[model samples]
Every structure is written in structure tokens, then in C-alpha cells.
Target: MKRVLLSAFSLLMCMSASAGVTFNPDKVKAVYIVRFANFIHWPQESSLKQINYCVIGNNQVTNLLESILVQHQVRNIPVVFRQVNNQEELDDCQLVYLTPESCRLGELKIDRLGLVTVSDERAFSESMGMVEFREKSGRIVPVINVDNVAKNNITIRSQLLRISKIISTPQGVEHD
Candidate 1:
């Protein structure tokens, strides 16, 4: 099993390299968001035609995400990119990538809409987002606030939870 998995990963890396995608932080961040979408489950009644991958205040990452989406699908659902401009535009987004400048849009409204928020912005998971990507020792670490995920009625598979840094509370206080 391990050998098969390793082989598949190697083949994927080779394909990525051949496709002109060199390993970089921006590309990694975009890939991470795409992978996260596969591991999270939205509410059952919220039918999806395509996964709406939204980005705010960053076009470079958005472009990178667009490239990755061309080769992948979230749970076999087609992904469409949306470069969002404001909070109101996020209503139908299933996944969102935010920068610190656009972090203000990572509000309770996102949770209510069942959006899986991922960001590299510091303290993003502690504030209102579900996942924050932090760089540690030359690797990007995903910090996840499972509480926020649950509040949004989304279920992240335990396999993903096991690999992430889990925090149950935000700001050292439990949610009311």
C-alpha cells in the first residue's frame, strides 16, 4: 500500500513538473486550498453544480488556483474560479482563499454560508476562518479550527484532521 501511494505521488509530482508548475509557495497555497475542498463535506441540502473557488484581493494566487483547477476536481465536481471583490460576493462560494488585506471578509457570514475558508493570513483560523496556512521550518503548516468548521455545518474527514494542527477554541476562549 505504501509503495503504491508513493508511486502515485511521484507520478503526480512528475506530471506537475512537466506541466510547467515549479514548486513555489504561491502554487503550494493554491494546491492546498484545492486539496482541502476534497476533504471537507458541505451540508447535504446545499446542492453543488460546481465548486466555487473564490479569491479576494490577490490575483496571482487566483491565477495559480485557476491553473490547478484545470487538472483537478473537488469530489468530482467541476471547479470554477471567482475573483471576489467584497463580502456580499461570497454567498455562493464553497471555498475561499484570503490574504490579510482581505481577511475582513472572513466573517461569521462565511460559516453561515458553509464556506471552507483557507488563508495564509496570521491568526486567521483564530479569528473566523476554518483553516490558516502558517509557514514553519520551511514548510507550510495548516492550522485548523475544527470549531469553526463544525459551526459552519461542514465536516472535515478525520484523516485531514489528523494531519493538521487542531485548535478547538479561538483566542483561548470557547465559542458561546
Candidate 2:
């Protein structure tokens, strides 16, 4: 099962890479944003009403996700998209995606309440967040920081861990 998932992920990476530079990055990212919600296990304490997705900066990615996920449900939970223009917006989101232009870890309080973080920054899993979407070989792939993920009290599915390059290096990413 692990191998199968890994191969599927590799195929996706290859396909994404082969896609021309004109490929809509936001669209692909939106697909992944939704998938992440499906693959991760949020804390049981989370509200069952909906899955809150916090978008910080990158209005293009934010808008794309909002449009795509508005009608979708992950694990039977309605996926709600919310814009994070300030720290106060971070209070209620379960998933957080920080655009490349968004503020870095030091400048913001991301560790609050075990937020599952995803970012476009390079090796973000190693220092800035749990999952990172990096462009490699002309493809966008996800890397996960296992240690960081555990620290947040979140459990990463083996399928996702299989496809993701797990890193444990500490580059100053903090948590509560």
C-alpha cells in the first residue's frame, strides 16, 4: 500500500513537472490543499461543523482554494475558506497555508493551538511548517517534517508520509 501510494505521488509529480510553465500553479495548489485536508488527522477536539482553512497572503492561491473548495467536503466536513489578514484571523483555522510572500515564522505566531501548516517556501517542513510544496524537476511536490508534525499533536497518515520526504532537521521552527 505504501509503495502504491508512493508511485502515485511520483506520477503526480512527473505529470505536474511535464506540464508547461504556463500551467496554473494556483489550480494545482488548490487540488493539493484539498487533498491535504483529506490525508491529515486533526485533533478530536476540533469542531465537526467544518474544516477551517486559513489563507494568509497570496490572494491568488487563496481565491483559487476558496472557489474550488467551497462546494467540497473532506471527511464529510464542509471545507470553509477564510482569509487571514491579521493574527486575529489565525485563532479559528485548523489548516493554514502561508504563501511565499507571507510573513515568516519569526514575525508571526503560528504555533498557536496546533495548527496544521502548509507553505510554498523551500524546505518549509524543516523550519517553517509541517508540509512544504516545493518545485523540483519542474514539478511541485510535498515534503513533510515528521518531528514538527508530531510536536503539533497531529498524526500524519502513512500514505502522505510515504509520498513526502520526511525531514527532522531543526532550523528554528517553533511551537506551543
Candidate 3:
């Protein structure tokens, strides 16, 4: 397990180093989110036969994720990447990486979807998505909203939550 963690970390570093000025930290962070998926446990009878990582807009994150996934397998399943043009496509993904541009599709009702949605926008409130990634002290970390995750039926591992910077919901509401 340590070896896998080390390998994953090494891959993350290499990706960050290789990312040019055009690459956004959010994109790099999105790649980290993809790595976290490996540690999660989905429902046993999930219709998803493969682990799908979808990017909602044109970004370097998909390329970075592809390169990293090529070297490693998640839960013994091959990781696949897809670029989504619409909400219909998003439904097929296990994790959806949404750019600021894609967030405008609020009418798509993505917040209520079962797939995990990740973004960099601070405007993403508790009702907007499950988790948001932020850059702190030169490192990217996830700010998970457990309530939203539970609403979507996504199971996040305790270990991942321990390291994450959790974002709390409104008063009187508890997160799973």
C-alpha cells in the first residue's frame, strides 16, 4: 500500500512539473481528485462496468490524468477518460471534472447527480456539488462537502476524508 501511495504521489509530482504555464493548478488538482477515486468504494452493483473520469471542458487535466492512469490501474480496473459535451454524457462518468465554463450548466441539475463533481470555483456552495479543490501553500487540496456527497450516494473513504479539508454545510445540517 505504501508503494502504491508513493507511486501515486510521484505521478502527481511529475504531472505538476510537466504542466506548462497553460496548465491551471485546478487542472492538476482535478488529477489528484481522480487519484482519490482509487481509494473509494462504489456500490457492488453499480452499473458502471469501468471507472470513467470525465472532463466537462477543454483542459489539460484530462491529458494529465490520461498519462498518469496509463501507468497505474485503479481497483484493478482500467481508467478511462472522456470529454463531455452535455449532461447526458456526464451521467456515464464516475467522476466529473467541471471547469468554470461548465458550471454555467446549472440547469443540468448536476448537483443532484450520483457522480462526483469537482471544480475550482469558490462560488460552488454546499448545494452546488460534492467537493471543490483549492490551492493552499503551493499544494492542491480537496474541500469536501460530506452532505452533498451523501445526497449523491457516493462513498468516500475515511482515510481520504482525514486528509481532506472539509467544507461544512449550513447550521442544523449534518454531513455523513
Q: Which stretches of candidate 1 lie over 4 Å from their true place?
A: 1-23, 104-109, 172-176
Candidate 3: count the clashes: 0
Model 3: colliding residue pairs: none
| lDDT tens readout by residue for model 3, 1-176 | 43765675656545543355243574457457667775565653255567777877765665676555654457666567777788788767777777767777676667644577777766463556777776776567677887777777778888878767776566324334
lDDT of 2 by residue, 1-176 (tens): 33443454344445643455355566566667777876788775356688889888865777877876656677667778888888888988889999877846457778754689888876567775888877666656677777778878887778767766667757633332
Q: For model 1, where is the 10-residue window of minimal lDDT? A: 1-10
CA RMSD (A), model 3: 4.7
What ranking of all candidate models by TM-score puts the best one first? 2, 1, 3
Model 3, position 39: C-alpha lDDT score: 58
Using TM-score as the measure, name the better of candidate 2 and candidate 3: 2
Q: What's the residue-level lDDT of 132 in candidate 3?
A: 76
User: Model 3 segments beyond 4 Å from truth?
Assistant: 1-5, 8-27, 44-47, 171-176
